[model samples]
Target: MRLSSFFMPTLKETPTEAQIVSHRLMLRAGMIRQTSAGIYAWLPLGYRVLRKIEQIVREEQDAAGAQELLMPTIQSAELWRESGRYDDYGKEMLRITDRHDREMLFGPTNEEMITDIFRSFVKSYRQLPLNLYHIQWKFRDEIRPRFGVMRGREFLMKDAYSFDIDAAGARRSYQKMFLAYLRTFARIGLKAIPMRADTGPIGGDLSHEFIILAETGESGVFCHKDWMNLDVLKDAPGMEDDLQPFFDRITSIYAATDEKHDPANSPVPESDLVSARGIEVGHIFNFGTKYSKPMNAVVAGPNGESVPVEMGSYGIGVSRLMGAIIEASHDDNGIIWPDAVAPFNVGLINLKSGDAETDRVCAELYAKLEAAGLEVAYDDRDERPGAKFADMDLIGVPWQLVVGPRGLKNGVVELKRRATGEKEELPVEAALAKLLG
Candidate 1:
């Protein structure tokens, strides 16, 4: 993509309303724009990153044996009533009435609706251990929505519902989601620690919140220092395998959100404890028959007895992750995007855009990079070198290739790594090889 044709409206100064680094940077970088309080319109650059994160979450869910299906944003109030939560869900639920005088709502979550779906077609234990998920928009009317997309009232989410025949099967489903969440976050270049957390409105005894530590996090957390060393993806268990041991290894460590932490009851010594602020990126719940039982989502057992299917729900904040990642990864310059989620793999900078030699070199490099299966954003506008560099850094492509008349005359160009701020002067061929490799 060429910057000359791109529609990134970057700002030179920080917006006064942005209280966090992620919020401020996102605005200054022209990734998103606020349409209302706690709601945003994702600009071109922002949408690219959002889709990348969504794909990662989708891939991991598929790997864990979960099937994908999209659900609607608007839900019937009758479904919530079946689960006995329509009245109890409080003001956050965006209740509305259609012209036909039927009550409706923008779903904050899909537990009730999914249960209704299960009860409709799934009749016997033959379809047990089924998992269905979707990536869709959700809305919750937050009383005080702030911090940009981090606390947005409207956001994108990936919610997966798992149905099993018994408590044992439910636990296995939960474990698979647990492992899947770990792998999903890692692939996005985040080290998310799974910590025991409150189920909140989801109403589950077994729950875990995947948190990424950041100074701008919304909540405090305590965990063992050893958590930093564990790689849940290494030698991961297959979907059909018994995941008990793998689950046990992760939950054995001391980890808790501030709401669940008890210093006196902690198994890890205080000397070995590491406390930090963390942003919640994903959550999973093993809610037995919470939704199924209330909604009468029953299936026939092997013994021919009617039983409510045990169920679990897994959620990853698809939109909120953009903010969480920025909080954890950005520097004073701007966002340093991870390679897997970056808007483009490389930024091609022509220091002298109108110069015949510089333009020729950059155009050639851009074509080579794109042919190598790379996403390149070529800065072809007639802008100052400093402005071009600033914009590239602010948008946070992983690598930047700088071409100028002087460098072209010398038969060399500069390659810079965004994350490490490392630079190397190499021949055009050498730079292409390094980037492709």
Candidate 2:
């Protein structure tokens, strides 16, 4: 993708309302536009990152045996009524009345709707452990919506529902999601600590929110420092296998959100009471029969007795994560996206755009990088070198390749690592090999 053709509307000034770092950078980068209060229209560049994150979330969930499905944004209020949450959910639920005086709503969460769906088709314990997930937009009527996508009223979410035969089965399913969430966050270059949280409106005593520490975070968190050292990839619990190891992995570290952080019975040493502000990017809950029982989602047990299927819901903020990643990985320059989640893998800069020699060399390099299956954004615009460099840094592509008449004449191009701010001059082929290899 060339900058001249890209739809990014890079700004010269930050929007007044964007107080948080992630929100400010997103606006300055021209990634998103506010369509309404707390609602945004993702521009080309923002949508690219959004889709990339969603794909990673999908891959990790699938690996954990959760199947993907699409769910509608608008759901009939009758579903919420089934669980007696229509009145209990409060104004946070975006209630609506149809033209014919029928009630409708933009779902804040899919627990009720998913339960209705599960009850309609799934019967008997023969298909006991089933997990279904969907990435969809949700609407919540936040009284004071702010902080850009971080606390948007309308946002994307990946919610997965797990159905199992018993409490034991539900715990195993929760552990599977627990492990998957750890891996999912790690792959995006985030160290998300799973902390126990208040169930809130979700109504589950068993819940954990995957949180990343940032000064801009919305919630307070306390945790042992050891969570930073655990690696899900190495400590593979094979999510489908025994969950005891999975349970042990999380138990090895003590973590909790402020609401559930019990100081009286705390396990961590007072010296290790590392408290920080954190953003909740993902949440999972083991709500045994919280939905199934209320909605009558029952299954026949081996003894032929009717039993409510235990349920759990797992979530990854499909949109909020984009902002959260920016909060964690960015610097004064702009967003330093994790290489795994960047809209593009590399930024190819041509110092003298349209200059015969410079153009020839950059075109070849861009072609080579693209042919190697890399997502490279070539800065092929007729802009000043200073502006080109600033824009490149602002977008925070992992690697930056600089081609100029002087450098190309010397048979080398300058390469810069966005994360390290390190620069190297290497032969074109050497740079290509190092970057693409």
lDDT of the candidates, in the order given = 0.94, 0.89
Give all TM-scores, in the order shown.
0.99, 0.97
Those runs of model 2 whose alpha carbons end farther than 4 Å from true positions after fitting are 262-265
Report the poorest 10 consecutive residues by lDDT, candidate 2.
226-235
Using TM-score as the measure, the top candidate is 1
Which lDDT tens digits does candidate 1 get at residues 187-206? 99999998887888999899
Model 1 pairs in collision: none
Judged by lDDT against the true structure, how good is candidate 1?
0.94
**What's the CA error at residue 6 for candidate 1, in Å?**
0.3
